[model samples]
Target: MTRAKIAKTLLTLPLLSAQLLACQPADGQNPAQPGQPGSLKTLSAPSAAELQSLRSSELPEANTRFALAFFGDLLNETPRENVFISPLSLSIALSMLYQGASGETRQEIADALRYSGLSEAEINAGNLTLRKRLQNSGKGVTVQIANALWGKAGLSFNAGFLSRNQAFYDARLEALDFGSATAVARINQWASDNTNGLIPKVIEEIDPMTILILMNAIYFKGDWSEPFEASQTQERSFYKADGTTLEHPMMQRYDKFRYTNNTDAGFEAVSLPYGEAEETEMILLLPHAGKDLASLRDQLTPENWQSWLSSLRSRDGSVTLPKFKLKTERQLNDTLRRLGMVKAFSEAEAEFDSLLDNSPLKAYVSEVKQDAFIDVNEKGTEAAAVTTITVGATSIQLPQEPFEMVLDRPFLYAIYDRATESLLFMGALNSPEL
Candidate 1:
């Protein structure tokens, strides 16, 4: 997963009734009604000590389970494409939404996210810790995470919902007229800016009935700690999943990388570190010849993933990896529905009472979209991803024995944070287009 760029779009429609909720008079007599315009209060930013404490906490096992499960589902659904996704981005956005969910809606999301046993405070704290850690700079590496919320003007939302998201996710909130083109442009501009223009647009058009949009953007750029010389990059035959071979520019480097050969798991893996922090590394998993990528992916359970990580060992190795770039757009609505989140998409049964002041308003998720891009070459790797969960939203490791790891065939790769064990970006390179 070298030199990659990614983006995503999500749209949620909360259908509101024409009747407005009754509220106390505008006079300064009683507290303002929840969701009323100007009634919401912004929560103050967390103190330095609080943020430090959060940073010290590790992501819960439940969060890891949800991430691995979602990755498995995405791989199963898109069996052929060059797939790449940011589980952290999706989780952060969903975690924000979870704060506003109640009853069955909360339970369904909790179940789907594997947050069943964790408290909302714990979930939010974990997300904050990872988000802040990923963005901190070390040597030549740069990882950035951004979040935002856009709401339809005049819509009354629960003040607590707004406050919680702001407090935890550091989301910037804006009120917009959904019918206006300017509003759409502004939102897209934010996406572009956050992703360093790798993703110029995440929203094509805003549905009239749509009342809110939640978004997350992630950007990563890093130079290899021991970069390959450009002169060593040579054209070589690269095998494709479809039994075809094409000439691709292959980068060759002889370096000491954490490597492993897992006979039980059926793949050879190598870890390529970036920058001085060595906190993030790209783990490449090349399945043994005769073993299909699909079958190997099927065995990628949480337990297996952990076992593979634990089995990785340090070894000096010769590496040959192709220079490749991929850009993809995927709709995750169907995949999410298959993952036991059936009620949220239903206009009839979806529950979002915590998000709005009016209990009678019925709303559901209409779409979940993502766009991503990546480019891996001799200098290093660059990747970007944007995830937009529109109410309707939806959204690892290693091996070694490899004294020599040549990724000339189809293989899987993951850009992971060593500190948090977070899979920032992942994909399978079936063919080398560049």
Candidate 2:
């Protein structure tokens, strides 16, 4: 199958959720409380030797490259809230990238998607078809794929009997003509159950000849060590891109935080870790007065991203930001293939010895979708994200000093692994209302 044909076949799929178990960091890493959702695990906490082995291995490079590319675009596009809670999410997401991909391909993809500010729910819902492909592959790839997909996309995932079933190991593409309505319903039920009803009515129904299904969900809650006093929250006017403004509940706090200022971009950035440094994290960027968010986003790039971080000059200052929550969903299949995952979707080039019993398969991503939800308040952050791939940052340091947190305009943000300097989530938010 050609890449074009394979992509054409990947558009169909499913929904998400699971139990809300508090995550403990593996291997002495920081463990986040139940409320800090993005603080899951990363790459299953590889041992030093194992990490070294993975680093030296020639396999998974393609996947890694793809991951980095995807994440770069995401960081460049996401809101500030999602950026802080990205590491654990990216780790789980990379596990999916590990699925049938290898060499530079896997690494690139892992690097990119791991921190691309995409929500776990959006990632999963959109990639169900790809998930279905691996789930039905009858190979060990299913666990690996599921882990990577969920981890990187900001979903909290745990491997268990359901994923380890022998029946799943023996499954095949018996032909794509089965009535998928029932299958779709069952999948939707699974999603509702997994999410504990956080997400309702996932897929309306599966149309006949459904090619794949991917789904995801996450639940997080956290309180700031020093939350903005309720008394400090007040209605304030917020200017929009248009010459319009709206009153919003703006939260204010004078607590100590990680902050910086960049004279070059005329902006100030603040970082507030969710828990300890090892747990999930969050960061916010505020442009200097008089600059709009769209302008900041337009100036964002990998190099500038690093420069922005490097330019941080922390100094104590008052901080105020709107207390808000937002949710959004989008279809992204075309966007992915357009980014360069041609082979996975082409009927002429699709190969799935990893997914089938050596049967020649014609697969193409039919669609890719994403659903993202987030809330920012004086307490902290709570969010859920889902994205489906199916087929498809630098930093700077500045003088150390206390900094202020003020978000008057749109700004860029990122979530990263403090240890590896790997970015797990990156994006810019021009409008919190979206």
Candidate 3:
């Protein structure tokens, strides 16, 4: 059996563009480009005290890194568009979704997506409106999602939980076969419609009672305002962990970049901003020669991450990165606990009753299943990810090498919130799974 692997604690920051890729509707994605007519900001601009004050003891600091599997490409060299999201508005939107969550699980989701930037009055007002929406939301597709999450039976939808198998919350008590082709077709159609054709289909079959499936899809289409010509693409060798290598199409450009070095790990980390100067940055951390990626990752404490950022020096070097398409899916329930979110998985400590209006809620996350699928071609990256929370069970990609950061063996990665120092998501890939 493949050993279970969780991502290292070294998280990556997912700025505005990355978040939009994960959450926004197709037509709503607003890219933030460099030299564009908008003001941009990042976590680096804040004071040390301010950074500290924003820290939360409730969430795991280790949850902040990016997790792209071995042999999997995490496309980091793409240019990103910028957008402004009012912290209050984003929080309200997420809260509304959480209110409909059932069982003893929604609290963790709310806490994870909470905001310190909002005032008490604002939070209260937002909660009221969100509650109303969940209660009054018509019998639309979204209601089906709420039903599945809250364990409402009879709905065609189901939450995969965090497990590797097929499990769902059916509060409506519907007898649904997850392996049915009809089931697969319904989900595929939903994905296609939701992504506005960006993701045509996610589920290909639904008749197998126990089928293991992995998925990740992202859709990003934006004009760079100043697009890179195909003629500018360069050929380069990306070092594989096996000591062999492959020549790949590498994107190259000379622009203002944020570069940093980690003395302990003997590697360099660089940041490439898409649109505005510092609005959203794609970070790449490369380990030095003869150093095990795992060993270097062991030293990735919050302090070290902060120190590494301090060492970053802006430069104008020519950057080269492989343009590759990669996708990854894994079981991550055990991983989240290893990273310090133990209470979330335990029935004794789970506190998600606030999400429902029931007493003595006898429910807990039975599993957590996640799948991430992303592709990078000439057009750009199209990726999608889903996390299933099963009360009785559980469930559930990226590319590119630039400046020769060869991830030969197992390594740590992350995608973070640059402004809040919050680790939005983190993963460790011990072995590359295709």
Candidate 4:
């Protein structure tokens, strides 16, 4: 009657999806759309007050700290161009990978993920609650998050690892023939379906050494609580980080927004709500006169971010932002290394011993990559990201000139759930790209 024995008994549990991954309606699909794919649980949207409590209680400083560090690293990758990422997606994928690690490998991943003082149980429970609650964070917004495990056909993994993720992450499992010619298409199709077609492909090819594939996809579409009128969108001079001007369509609107002008911190910010409840919001950060995006990026610490968000207040102003659409792709190996996740990626040093039941091929994370897309128009925002850990793993505001804020230069933006206070996405746009 032991837990291990129970898992062992369930080792050959029916595959959650067809062995061939035939594309059809997903299992236990959410009522929202075509790609609900085995959600297993339906979570009700929390009230604004409940969301505030969740943000305060569930969202500890660790994930937020990691999010900021992750963003800073991405900015370093491409200092003066456009870059966007979903920290939530990346964390979920890596966390799923983290479930299989042991010894030094586990320790390193915990450190890299900023889970230093927390137990794995704590992290799992927190992720579960946050993910469940945030799905309905915005009253009129659509936020879908999906996770799946694609194992090499007939592979038997540690039952504990699989069950833990299934319990905490609602991740579905499917057996897949890695050697199948259509393997790539099947995965890409799942990614497309889950992300509402925002990201149609995640992997170009399956490495011969690959045995397992874990994916996390997030799709978000929200209309601004107060949308910018299309009639007011006009060409404006937007200065790039390189000091060149790019004339792009800037959507203009006047409204009272949660605004902050912190001269000492070298940035000004504004918060724009998404749905009627306003539990989900986008925050915009612009470095004022003397500060640039680089300096602003450097200041992206958890402490500074908290200070910035706390300092916001209602202010009357006219806000101008560009109508932009951009896509991003990144290989996270280097970034993970920089963030101190050295052991997991090593073919020899890595110890994902808890992953497979009895495979002699040896398992170590081989790749970690992510693809994300974002479109910010007058209607609101449509964004999606797929973080595929090939064992690899892994906003705002406004206000007028003086009382008017014009994001005619490089700036930062974020989409977040106020209830969980968890950052869903973040980006730096030097110049508007459509």
Please tell me which predicted candidate would have the highest TM-score against the true structure.
4
TM-score of each: 0.85, 0.61, 0.52, 0.86
Tell me the deviation in Å of residue 51 in model 2: 6.6
The lDDT values for all models are: 0.68, 0.39, 0.34, 0.71
Candidate 1 ranges beyond 4 A from true positions: 1-58, 392-402
Name the better of 1 and 4 by lDDT.
Answer: 4
Across 230-300, the per-residue lDDT of candidate 4 in tens digits comes to 99999988877676777788898888888887878777788889989988888888777646778788888
Query: Which candidate would rank higher by TM-score, 1 or 4?
Result: 4
lDDT of 1 at 71: 72
Model 3's lDDT to the true fold? Answer: 0.34
Best by lDDT: 4
Model 4, position 382: C-alpha lDDT score? 88
How much is the lDDT of residue 390 in candidate 4? 56
Tens digit of per-residue lDDT, candidate 2, span 1-434: 10000000000011221111111112321111122111122223335554444334432232233434444444445433232222223333333433433334433333344324433333332333222322232211111122211111121122322132112221111111125455545544544443344344545544332333334433344445456788988876655444455666777777655566667776666655554332334456566666655445555555665566565443555677776555555554443454654444444453322221222233333444554455667767555454443431004454444444555445555543233333434444444452
Q: What TM-score should be assigned to candidate 2?
A: 0.61
| TM-score for predicted model 1 compared with the true structure | 0.85
Span of 10 residues, lowest total lDDT, candidate 1: 10-19
Better of 2 and 3 by TM-score: 2
As for lDDT, the candidate ahead, 1 or 2, is 1
